[model samples]
Target: MKEVYINRISKYLPNHPISNDEMEGKLGIINGRASKGRRIVLRNNQIKTRYYAIDDHGNITHNNAQLTKEAIVGLCDDDFKAEDIELLSCGTSSPDQILPSHAAMVHGFLKNGNIEINSPSGACCSGMNALKYGYLAVKAGQTKNAVCTGSERTSSWMMADTFEEELQYLQTLEDNPILAFNKDFLRWMLSDGAGAFLLESEPKGHLPLKIEWMEGYSYAHEVEACMYAGGDKLEDGFLKPWSEYPSDQWSKKSLFAMKQDVKLLGENILVKGVDSLKMALDKNNLKPEDIDYYLPHISSYYFKESLYKEMIAQGVEIPWENWFMNLSKVGNVGAGSIYIMLEELVHSGKLKKGDKILLSVPESARFAYAYALLTVC
Candidate 1:
C-alpha cells in the first residue's frame, strides 16, 4: 500500500480571545447564582482564554464557511493552487446551514473549479473521520493529494437569544447550576477556530507526518442522546416533530437549541475513550511505548487524572508527561481541536526527524471515538 503523508498543516484563529474574567460579563453570570458555577467550571476546565469569531461588542463576525475558507487558504501558497486540489473534506459539529454541507459551502468560497467533496458531519470525532477519509483515498491511489479541514464557530450556537430564559430555568433547579446549565457552561468552554491539513502520497518537505494507522469507533447504544443538537428525542427513542421546537431553533440559522446530558458525558467518555484507544493500539500492533508524543483531544483538564488512572489500571503505561493538551489556550474546539494541536506541536520544535505520534479524539455525542498513528519524518 502506498504511504500517505501530511505535507503541511495550517490553522486560523479568530482575534477575540475571551479570558475567564471577560467571560463572566459576556455570559451575564455576574452576581447571579450561576456565578459560582461559572467559576467552578473555569477552575475545573483550566482554560485561560479561548478565541471567538465575534467582535468586541459580542456579535458574530464570521460564519462557519468563512472560517473554514481562512484555514484552507492558509494552507495554500504560490506553489499550491486551490483548483488543483483533488479532494476536499470538511468536518464540523456546527454549520451555517443544514441543507448545504459545510464542505459544499467552503467549496463555494474557494471557487476552486469542480472537485470531489466530502463533509463528515457529527460530533468532534468527525474531524478525524475527515482526515482518515482523505488518507485512505491517497493511500489507495484514488487521489494524489487532498485537503482536510475542520472548522467550528461554536460561539454562535452558544450566544442564544433565549439565554435569560435558560438562566431562569437553571436558577430553579436543585442540581448544581454548573451541571444544570450545561449549555451555558459549555459557552465558556468552546470557542471558534479552523484547521486544515494538506496530505499527499509523497512527502513535500521536511517534517512531514507519515500516516501509520487509523481507526474509528462509535458506541451509540452506550451513549444515546448524551450530547445532541436539533430535534429532540421522544421517550420511545423516536425523534420529536421538528415543528415542536421554536422555528428559530432550526439548524438553518444560528440557534442554541442543543440538549446535553452533561452527567452522561462525565460518566462515559473517560472509560470508553481509553478502551477505544487500547483497541486502536492493539489492532495497529503498537504498544504504549511505541508512541513518543500523545495528542489527546479531551474536552477539559477535569478528565486528565481519570484518563491517566484508567490507562495505568488497564496496563498501558504511557507516561503523563508524554501527553500534550491545548484546551487551556484553545478551549474545547470540538472537531478542530486535534488539527490545531497537531499544527501547534509541529511549530513548537518538540519532535525530531523521526518520532511516533498517537492522536486520540473522543466525542460525547453518541460517544464516537477515533485514533491515529503517525510517524514524523
Candidate 2:
C-alpha cells in the first residue's frame, strides 16, 4: 500500500470572531426575548469568541458550500494546486440542502473539473470519516491526491427566525414562551467555519503529517441518540425522522432545531469515549506516554475536567500539558471542529519533527466516535 501524508491543511472562518457579549445581537432573540440559558452555556463552554458566517445586519455571508470551497482553495500552491485535485470528500451536520450532497454543492462553488467526491454525513466524527476516505483512496493508489473538507453553516439554523413560531405556539398552549432547553441550548454553543486537508501519496509541504493509523467505532446499538436535529425523539427513544411528519409541523414545532438530551449526554458520553480510546490504544500497541500531543474534539469546557478524570479512571491518561485543544478559542463547529484545531496547531509553530499527535472525536449524536494518530514529518 502507498503511504498517505496530509501535505497541506487550511481553514476558513467566515468574517470576524464574534465576542460573547455580542452574540445575542448577532443571532437575535426569539420573539425579542433574550435567551435565559446563554450565560450559563457560555460560562460552561468557556468560549469567549467564535466565528459566524453572518454579517452584522443578520445577513448570511457564506453558506456551507462556500465555506468549504474557500478551505479547499487555500490548499493550492506552486507544488500542488487545486486544479490537480482528483477527489473531494466533504462532511457536515448542517448541509445547505438535503439533496445534491455537500461535496457536489462545494464543487459547484469551486468551478473545478469533475472528480470523484464523497459526502459523509453525521456530527463531529464525520470530519475524520472524510479524512479516512481520502487517506484510503490515496493509500490504495486510487487517486494521487484528494481534498477532504469538514464544515458547518449552523449559525443560520440557530437564528431567532427558526424558533419564533415555535416559541409563540408554546406561549398560546402552555403559557411558556421560552424555547425548549434542548433546542435553544445549542444556539449559544455552536458557531460556523470550514477546514480542509490535502491527502497525497508523497509529502509536499514544509511539514507533513504521516498517517499512522485511524480507528472508528459506534455505540448506537447500545444507546439512543443524545443530540439530533430534523427529527423528534419519542418516549421510547426512537427518533422520528422529519420525513415521517407533516411539513406544517416542521416549522410550527421547530422540528428541525438541534436538540440534545443533556441528562443522557452526561451519563454516557465521557465513559464511552474513554472506552473507545482504551480499545484503540491497546489495538494500536500505544501507551499514553507515547503521545506528544492529544487533539481531542471536545465540544465544551463543561466536559473537560470530567473527561480527563474519566480517562484516568480507565487507565489511559494523557497528561494535561499534552492535551492540545482550541475549543475555547474557536467554539464548536461540529464536524469542522477537529480540523479547525489541527489547522491552529499546525500554524502555531509548536510542532516539531517526530512529534506524535493523537486525535479523538466523540459525537453524542448516537454515540459515534473516531480516533486517529499522526506523526509529524
TM-score of decoy 1: 0.91
For 204-231, candidate 2 gives per-residue lDDT tens digits of 7778999999999999999998999999
**Model 2 regions more than 4 Å off:** none
Question: What does the lDDT read for residue 194 in candidate 2?
Answer: 95
Shift of residue 328 alpha carbon in model 2, Å: 1.2
lDDT of 1 at 141: 95
Cα deviation of 23 in candidate 2 (Å)?
0.7
Deviation (Å) of 74 in candidate 1: 0.9
